[model samples]
Target: MSSGKEPANGTSGTVRRRTSTRSVTLRDVAAHAGVSSQTVSRVLRIPDEVAPHTRARVEEAIRECGYVPNLAARNLASNRSKIVATVIPSLSASVFSETLTGLSDVLAPEGYQLLLGYTDYDDEREEALIRSLVGRRPDGIVMTGAVHRETIVAMLRTARIPVVETWDWTDTPLDVLVGFSNERAMYEMVCQLHGAGYRRPCFVGSLPAGDHRARRRLAGFRRAAAEHWPGREPRVVDASGHPLTLESGARLLDVARGAHPEADVLVFSTDIFANGALLAAARRGLRVPEDIAVTGFGDFELSRMLHPGLTTVALPNATIGREAATLLLRRMRGERPTTRTIDLGFEIRRRGSA
Candidate 1:
């Protein structure tokens, strides 16, 4: 696992016990070199911070003990962290989960490991997490969303490491990027709905925060609605992210029934949200596509399993991860990847929902 520890082997004799921690610390290096911890720290932090001879001795001690510095200290010293820390919202969600799986699959061959963290959809938390991750100075930084804090953007600008934004794309990328256009894809899906004989469409999903990706999708939906309906616009039913269960789908249905009783179709940015919307529709005795059509993106597994299966746009999440990882490895190897934004294409899986 590269845990910075030596593997233990069983012995025959009764072993004398010592502290288990052994990968080398400043104290250990200092003791080995007959110096103080502060001196060793300075040397480890940077050779220029200490005398040349002392730095040489510390280096020797480090080599002898097979020591690896703490990630932060090492990063500050060498200006690069070998680990690629990926921060996402929740790992339990299929979209990010599948995307992460794709990232792992692609990076495995390139000797890069992913160090991941979660932010629970909080913008401030995400900003803080990205800041902390950046302090470590990773070789490459891969984030779930394209939008980031201004401070984070500034950090990426000077970090000299490739920051690859996945799950969505923008016109201006920090360095390298991959994945489909979230807003444009939603626009296309809306276009599909218009072509399917649906006039007024409503969006059923979480309330848009400053989440640029979600906002983009919403904007696209609005644009499509404006283009198709001319003057009449569709209503948006924004839901809470708390207690995300299938039952909550019913609430969205209630909203649809109450607010947009005249609307003919509902478009969900995510399949999970769409699933909930569909469930609510079935319970309301509304025959999908007959009474009110439902459409979704990220073609989840359940999209195909439901009765009168959901009509959705299939997003190649795994393909995105694979491509993102490939691009990252190429950048690491000084091989510049040609494309920044990869469409991966979208397919309309029309079963019965819309």
Candidate 2:
């Protein structure tokens, strides 16, 4: 079906249709840009190698034709996906989202994309995500915590890709660790509360069995309570199977207050809980740090804005993300980092709430 007549403007000396059912190809871009197919390929693979004016013309042609480079074919040729897979517990929480922001800030400049997955604090769901993400052969993987099922660990080992575990510290990490000690941070928080003469402090948190970090925090609270108040059992209200939220926090506050009327301070595992408790107290017309004092972890922005600004443990959430990404990048480049574990530590911020 060759047209004997030349095309309008006589650019290629062949008749060309403006529209076609077939997908646009490199040759099509080349023809439209008035360049050879090789030049178009070079522009795609290494734009810096091509002259500026030629590169601009090819780039313009690409945009006009709506050409999408075949990433699968390109990856196969280069043996790299240029993608990083990250799995975290919750998307609703600002803690994880802030970390993701830091991760993106570092990864984006290097031309890497993130494949995100959320587990909602479920180990089995995390294991499933690990399996699926590993199957895709990403350049690297970043997980929320150091704890993982043995099968998941073995699968990642077999895959032999760079892996980074963040948000919780561990001496024996699966590959690399970038986080602070949850136990140490909570321990310091409790110690600070005790030092401030807040006796009969009660810990309110989610079920420890579901989250290792929460378990560590509970252990820290217990350790500090035992040391500070001898022979007195540490009061605790376990919000079993409840999602960490303002409503749950408010409900837990009522339960803790009812059960432990003698307790002077209520230390929550996260700011969401503590903030909820504050709201409940406000609604009930109770004065904070007089009727009861409240403290929380993850010094959220809302914590600072509350009627009585919350006293909480401030973690280096974004720094953890940036450090994890940096370590992953180093490992991906075949560099063996001498230090596999990094502990950024935490700070306890004292505010009107406590």
Candidate 3:
């Protein structure tokens, strides 16, 4: 009888060996680089400690072997996951997405990676995400917006890791804050519109229920309108329960005009809504500025591309992300910042649309 180890061809009694499908390990990298396993480990953990030539050789071997470091084991030994967790309202929005790009630009080069979580503008979801991320023992956490539930604040404080809040400013941040005053930004925009001799202004956007930023913006509009025109309540068209899209913006334009025909200007919560209104106006054979003026928050790229361009608030979205990452890095390195809050500020871009 033939042994099982015999070759399938049966030409000779030679045994066929099975190739290993196991992942490449540190020892394998060391062997490929002609160095010890400890040297490979040191090259990954502390490259400065190893010579330049040796570090280059190890890195080349790692690339050649497609070696992926075992982060779990490294985390256990160093007590640091080298991961930063970030929670934002929406990943599809350019405002938040640009901020993420800024974050990655600064953090990736520092050997840190991001773990992203989306809240869909839900407070409860945000709280749940924060709880889950904290449990993961991340080296740092970056949260969008300053307004958070008490439980979330308490959990973050107890975790004792570096926490950074971005996008919205607050005097009493949980740890560190990197954002501008949403209220003040909106307030200034209203004032600028008023200066341009546009009376009977109307606000259009989502309700201040789940979105704290939108709520603050609305408050600013009300405050400014009240101050500018005493006893005259600001007109608002609620776009709640609707996605902030051009289509929604177009529909809201018709609603706003129908509800308040006397309104001379429509100020949107975002450029997406404003752009939609502009398109809708054109389709209705209405002239801009002459028939009805339009303005928006967040100077999106499409804003400039739109006809007559969009008059909107230009927020430092990317700067907020970069600053938040830099601040988190400082805290993770056990360095205390001179100030806990960093306000990047915002600017109002007046284009032809208004």
Candidate 4:
């Protein structure tokens, strides 16, 4: 029977009794498992701190009694909080969200909780968030975009937790990293555009801002243009990648149109900018791929659905997350994890737009 009432958890609806009569506590579980309170604490806080037999006994007791530890209280006793934190510059794009999905998928089965923080592209904010995450002393840390303040890098080096940096790659990594080649991806796109008969192309999007990945892509794009075209380097407008938004795309369209009237193609840093370019081009009465060809990164779903589907660089967002999380878990199990970086693959999406 369904009731419109709520339980003693405090609601105006009907209530149902819990399946178990007794509230499961750490002490109760310890007693049932024939272990001391201290042992149980050790088992929960740092399972590796206890012997295998003791851990098994504690876990068995937890399962049998349906015991749940108070996370807040448990965190205070040990340095390891058993929580994982992922700091993203922004979660607005489905790309980051998908990455987050992968992270959670891997962590959930291990009985560890994942926490999220958004720095909104502010370096100072990132520094602050890093401090907070460090204070919690989580078992693992996953960060988006490898660019970090020196203090944050030092902190991660000292925190001694399993750290996985994702979304972008550099020759050096803080620890384990799962990412795609942002610079090379852009380089490949630029070469493709040139071979496709784009003699005068202009790159659009925000400056790297505080984002090292976007900057690298920009650098690669410029390099390709300068190398292939020689004296005809593509025109570029640097928007701030820090507060990256679709609105920046509008500005990009105007800037490209005004500065490089001879441009036959425009390379945008992301789908958001690409979409804006599309709208701006339409409003300016320019035909896509005819008067002006547009290309974007991060082949989001909307890229295909739009008129004259956007040609873009597709990043394996979910795959990066899954791989990063998996790596962290392996490290947490005391396995010696090698390879600080994992470069997931990406591709160029050819569409009607370019």
Candidate 5:
């Protein structure tokens, strides 16, 4: 038979534990603060309107109970989400990280939250993310690039929210544009290298499919190379895919070396790739700027610190993010900007590597 003695209190047999599974509500906070629910709500929404003592009590109760306001409900009631959605290619790149940080720094001060999404350079994924972000009813949306699928463009038009596209420029943008022309920038970069007497240049970059920015750069590179070095076909190597990592860069460099060993100047789509090519050249016992000249786009910090310092196109990553946020914030406040496009141009950093 079972021992029928009910566990006595403090007898080390059994203890009754009360665990409240219910979520803390406004009424509970009001009860804890010894105030009406409306007073608690006022304290949360408009603290200055509530008496100082009441507000303090409500705040204390909130802290004690770890109360978190339902943002969705609040947003519905206010008809303002106070959220900005940003979609970029990849967070693995430091440029995108810097952009995000710049956006957060500006938006956080204005009581707005940033929701981030990564597309990994896929148009379909970008469209999906845009759809999801639109469903959240964000106050504004910031897209990384201007190039989007037709469906994405149509959705953006239908959503009717303030949109800012960065990283690349176009004559026509979805809404506000805050970026330099990748094509022109790369074209000018090629001119710079050519002017510096580095002939026989080759463009090494990812496959021209989802990455429209890289394709634009390649187009610029090809045009510049054809005009500068006639009769010699442009040595374009599709290192292929989103090879943003150093290992991928190194492997691509190996491919480039085997294909175009005569290339004196190698223009990479990214600094990470250039850095990898630099290491690959070192491993092959080749001297930088002597045996080969290395250059890259997006002057990452490593590009500056590397031995023989990588020559690269220095893009204003942080500025793009900050400007995009500023534009969105202006629109969020019911202010129309004088200009829809802001071309924050780039510069070519010439170093020993080139």
Candidate 6:
């Protein structure tokens, strides 16, 4: 029998001494810097409190020892997580990606980090995400869209934290608004198409059960079409079975054309779907803008690169994200904006596709 402290024998009976690999702590950095633990804390927390030479020495020691501060303990002491929670429909989409990039650009410099969640455009999932995020006690919260369940709205209201509702315009914002009018934008899109001599235009998109914004846009288009082109029945295709993809767009356009053979133009809810529709038409030996005109929402990168250059509505995705982050930062710092609603409107880009 060997003592626990004795060197262990290897496979060949060669003696070997074990070494411990413990993480370097604050005390280690302090010892290496020849300073007290309090001084080391001050250097990290408020470098201005320490002399320039002392701060430099402590920083060098920290690097030499690879010392890392315990953020958990620090957060407990400061009562701040320095985290901003954001919940969006989906990150796979460029709209949300752009916004997230904008938020990170502004928040990173201020020592704030983003905690993200996806709701898959479901109200119940969003409610669950909200509950989970609120439980984390983040410094602020940013949510996409104005439409939320009553329980979600009530929970956010009761939390008393700064909340920002983005990507849609609403008079009764949960806290702050950093978005545009989806209804007005779609209405204007329909009017734009109608102005260009498209009398029989049909709307194609997913069902209302998943996307409330799409439903609102569809309503706006219907209202505008009724007012502008009365006596002509509007055509709508329920493409809700599949995810909002180019393939779905292609399939839905085929169905819409079949239902309304006289339809001269197709207005898609998104550019990806419109691209699919364009491909489908091309496959059927149809000439774009001559045989049938097509338009889409969200002027994403793919829209610009398309053969005919798709005519779509350009949204300020990154700008919305940056503005939302700025507003949250201001609110966190005890500053209030003169107005909470910041409407960054959309623009209709005319292209060969329409």
Return the top candidate by lDDT. Answer: 2
Candidate 3 pairs with clashing backbones: none
Q: In candidate 6, which residue ranges exceed 4 Å CA deviation?
A: 1-22, 48-57
Order of the predicted models by lDDT, top scorer first: 2, 3, 5, 6, 4, 1
User: What are the models' TM-scores?
Assistant: 0.77, 0.93, 0.91, 0.80, 0.89, 0.89
Candidate 5's TM-score reads: 0.89
Off by over 4 Å in 3: 1-21
Q: Please write out the lDDT profile of model 3 over residues 1-354, one tens digit for every residue.
A: 756553333234232222486777777677777788899989998999999999998898888767888889878998999899999988768988899989999999998999999998898998899889998999999998889888888888888989999989899888899999889998999999999998899999897466899899998999999989989878999898678788999999999999999999999998888999999999999899889999999899999998889999999989988999999999999999899999899999999888
Give each model's clash number: 0, 0, 0, 5, 0, 0
lDDT score at residue 258, model 6, on the 0-100 scale: 89
Query: lDDT of each structure?
Result: 0.76, 0.89, 0.88, 0.82, 0.87, 0.86
How far residue 204's Cα lies from its native spot in candidate 3, in Å, is 0.5
Off by over 4 Å in 5: 1-21, 34-36, 48-57
209-282 per-residue lDDT for model 2 (tens digits): 43888889998999999999989889998886567789988888899999999999999999999999999999
Which ranges in model 4 have alpha carbons more than 4 Å from their true place? 1-68, 75-79, 241-243
lDDT of 5 by residue, 1-354 (tens): 968653332233232222486786777666666678899889878888988887887898788767788988989998999899999888888988999888988999888999999998888888889999999899999988889999999998998999999999998999889999999989999999889998888899986467899999998998898899877789988877645788877787778778999988889988989998888778888899898899999999888998889999999989888888899999888898899999999999999899
Deviation in Å, model 3, residue 179 alpha carbon: 1.0
- Give the winner by TM-score: 1 or 5: 5
User: Which residue pairs of candidate 1 clash?
Assistant: none
Candidate 4: 10-residue stretch with minimal lDDT: 9-18
